[model samples]
Target: MTTDPQVVALPMGDLTFPADGAIFPGQTVVVVAYAVRHAGGVFLFDTGFREAAPGDDPELREYFQKYALRTRSLPDVLAAAGVDLGEITAVANCHLHFDHSGQNALFPGVPIYVQPAELAAVREPDYTLPEVYDFEGARFEQVAGDHEVAPGIRIFATPGHSPGHQSLVVETPDGPVLLAGQAVYTRGEWAGIPGALVGSSDTRPGADQAGYARSVARLKALNPRRVLFGHDRQGWPD
Candidate 1:
């Protein structure tokens, strides 16, 4: 506990769907909530699952067919991880995906950092559940670009999967750590798949494919010592 607590990955819930309707292993996603414990306080990155639940979006539920709509409580999950939710200083989301921002309502009046671009994107139909964010006393601190939210934590724009998608860069005692979010979908992508996204294209600026490439390249430029994800649940260190 002496060293700045390495970002803790909290398993919130699972998003599973028939991968191919064949005998192959079905695609199952474990949504993870990260807690970065700093000297100032515990800065939570992605607080959707307090207990466990499937996505609330109708289309997702109809297609996926399996997901817990809600979990216990954000505070309970934090407590189980030996983190007091009360000590939580602020919150941030990689994007406005339903699974990522489901439990944001837990922190009313608390400054929730999000990109203004994303805020605009979410207003469109079927983007995300509006109630999850537009709650009473909700305070959003719209950030435009890379910002140092804390002493050693910076949220950088990684837009690709979503226009406003962002990633966290935390300076741990070990080295720079990148919470890739969905910017880099899997470790395989980070490890360099031939068809994987690398950088943005000059032609299409915000296009999914090109934007994603640029975002990935931007993170790679940082040369983070450790990278985390929201869906990937594999062991980090072998």
Candidate 2:
């Protein structure tokens, strides 16, 4: 029998944005990641922010200084969920933004799944922190389209926020759970509630407004039992 995997939300701490004309100027939002524990192994989605350190690349230092990013201990967060660092078998990033793929280097020799376009975009100037993912032992498996990452776990392209952004669908015992990473800012945005606020791809920097709309519509068609956000601490179906 193929039993459903258990999904746990990993609290990655908070990010307080400075006024930059985006939806979250001067606002602090939660940084979250998810761990899917299956018979095969633990698959991680979105690896929080990279902590600032001395002697870091000048660009990296500047990036951290720019956002004033704060992050929780990855090991501690995983430990709280009964997971160990070495036990992580795979990684999948919704996109390669600094906040989403910062800790990817931690999982060396592990297959990190990502969209081809996302990978290419990350290489561009001011796209993301390259040092974060381009480290020794880093193994990237570019997934161009919908792929079965593991049993009952599927990742499909949901590009908008980034050229290759994707969302995850986990078939939990309760029902399908959608991990909408920055595809939509919050449940209000996903629900299409009028006057919902502007923090999603439609309003975020470097976003494709039309693509984002289509992506959100596609996600709605899935009819997930619960919807989760990368920045929102709350889950849908509340």
Candidate 3:
């Protein structure tokens, strides 16, 4: 109900990050989403969380289930934040990973903006639970590159964390805000970790460390007055 060109952050759900050679091995990460009112409607940056039965091997489900420890409906968060489900005009994500896209069912037929590359990537084997991305009545708008999803809301390609990874840039009352998805996974990596963004460029093949570096650095250079992430509980410039 409040229109002030501001971005609001709220808790959507939670997930456990993979401990396999990762910074926060098997650590619990809070799933967060961003919402903003523009042009008489609300737009969601990401759907919080959802868990699904294993698609192929039953064991995969067992492991995946471990990652999705718990969840809360996005609608509840929206309601508490004073957002109307009917007012949501569109949905965009930093990427289509399970934790990020699981709740797409919340807004069936709503134009879900996604990167074409990400869509392609998921189709590959073992990316994630296909049911999460392929749901009934789910609508997707595949974008190839940087494009504005709404007035003052632009989604630009920042493929590093994922081949089709993207980030959101929105102009708010405070200033420009950047929702940097997994490009900057946590506050610790946000401190400085090139490999974390794109993998070890020199030793890793097709890691696209250069691409990830540029994308992460771009978000930093863009110098958003505030920044948010897919997994981090805290945002910068708080």
By lDDT, the best candidate is 2
Q: Report the number of backbone clashes for model 2.
A: 0
Over 1-238, each residue of candidate 3 has an lDDT whose tens digit, in order, gives 6554567786877777567724356667788888877875787888876655445457646756667558877788888989988889998877777778878887889999888888888887656666766688988999888898777888978987677888889887777888887777765566654434322232322236777888888888887888888777777755
lDDT (0 to 1) per candidate:
0.74, 0.84, 0.75
Tens digit per residue, CA lDDT, model 2, 201-233 = 345456788888888889889889999988878
Cα miss at 167, model 3 (Å)? Answer: 1.0
TM-score of each: 0.81, 0.93, 0.85
- For residue 5, model 3's alpha carbon misses the true position, in angstroms, by 2.4
Supply the global lDDT for candidate 2: 0.84
Per residue, candidate 1 scores C-alpha lDDT tens digits across 35-97 of: 998878888888764332364456645533544343436677778888887888899988887
| Candidate numbers, best lDDT first, in rank order | 2, 3, 1
As a whole number from 0 to 100, the lDDT of residue 94 in candidate 1 is: 89
Cα miss at 130, model 1 (Å)?
Answer: 0.3
Stretches of candidate 1 above 4 Å error?
Answer: 1-5, 18-26, 49-72, 193-207, 235-238
Which portions of model 3 miss their true places by more than 4 Å? 1-4, 18-23, 53-60, 193-207
